[model samples]
Target: MAATLDQVRVPRARAGRPRTRPDRVLADKGYPSKANRAWLRTRGIAATIPERDDQIAHRVRRRRRT
Candidate 1:
């Protein structure tokens, strides 16, 4: 099976053309991960993914000062 989209725009094809990238991407619960955030930062893409419950608990346990 394959997904035949109406149009596809990739960042790789346009080194010469101006890159008008999106400001941010919003992913739901299934995509809340540290690596995902880091990757988005590398590309200057803001993410709107909420932290998972386990991640929130760990952060709260270790980062009490904040």
Candidate 2:
């Protein structure tokens, strides 16, 4: 679930349009699978999701590029 403030309160505090964009977003690991990250990148959202442990290990072993 979204934070309570986001769901019911923050919308009313928007300074401009209802679709006002954010300067950045902070996210947890669960939100940044490959496809999700790619989609967010396509839209220019700066995602801060960290790689899962298994993903980190695999990347290290294979020298995969981000």
Candidate 3:
């Protein structure tokens, strides 16, 4: 997904440089890994991907322990 995002080019409505980064990314659970999220954060891209079931469960367990 990161590789795909790197190749994105958003055409400008006016005469200007094309956008290299997108405003946001909407993806499914398959793209919700920690590395992917961190990469998007560093690049200032917003993600709307849902957490996987195991990730959610792990989060819940960790919260309960604290």
Candidate 4:
């Protein structure tokens, strides 16, 4: 996916290199793993995805115990 993003080209009016990286990435809960989120963060891209139900439940359970 990173490679694909790098290959993207957007024409500009002034004349310069095309846009390589996107400003943000929107994905579903299935794509919001720790590694995936870390990867997107490292690339300076914002990710807008909700946590999975299981993850949310686990967090809530843990919080209650503390």
Candidate 5:
């Protein structure tokens, strides 16, 4: 995933350097890992990755307790 993301090159309209960081990433649940999400967050990239089933269940349980 890191290798794939590093290869991204979005050209500028006027003229300049290509964008290394994309505006957003739409990935599957399988791609939503703590490391992956943190990487995108630090780069200020928006991600549309769904939480895994276990993660969702854990979140729900935690919420109910509070």
Candidate 6:
């Protein structure tokens, strides 16, 4: 999916290099795993995805344990 996103080229109005990357990406909780978030971060793309419910619960449980 990232590769496919990189292949996209949006033309510029003033005759410069077309945009090869997007400013941000919107995704649902299903796509917000640590690996996916890290991958997007490495590419300098901002992602607006909510964490999974299980992940949230795990964090809460871990905090309580600590």
Highest lDDT model number: 3
Residue 29: error of model 4 in Å?
Answer: 1.6
Q: Over the stretch 1-66, how does candidate 1's per-residue lDDT look in tens digits?
A: 002111323365546753444467777787787777787777687889887898889888999876
Better of 3 and 6 by lDDT: 3
The TM-scores, one per candidate, come to 0.59, 0.61, 0.85, 0.74, 0.77, 0.76
* Minimal lDDT window, size 10, model 2: 1-10
Query: Residues 1-66, candidate 5, lDDT per residue (tens digit)?
Result: 788999999788888999998999999999989999999999899999998999999889999984
Give per-residue CA lDDT, model 2, range 1-66, as digits (tens): 134213332243647545433435677777667776676666575767777898889879888564
- Please, what are the lDDT tens digits per residue for candidate 4 over residues 1-66? 456557767566688986766778788777878888888899898989899999999989999994
Q: Compose the digit string of candidate 3's lDDT tens values, residues 1-66.
A: 989999999888899999999999999989999899999999999999999999999899999994
Q: lDDT order of candidates, best first?
A: 3, 5, 6, 4, 1, 2
Over 4 Å off in model 2, which ranges?
A: 1-15, 64-66
Per-structure clash totals for the candidates: 0, 0, 0, 0, 0, 0
**Candidate 3, RMSD to the unseen true structure:** 1.3
Clash count in backbone of candidate 6: 0
Q: Which sequence of candidate numbers ranks them by TM-score, best first? A: 3, 5, 6, 4, 2, 1
lDDT of 4 at 5: 55
lDDT digits (tens) for residues 1-66 of candidate 6: 567677888677797999987778888777887888898899899999998889899999999984
Poorest lDDT segment (10 consecutive residues) of candidate 6:
1-10
Indicate which candidate wins on TM-score: 3
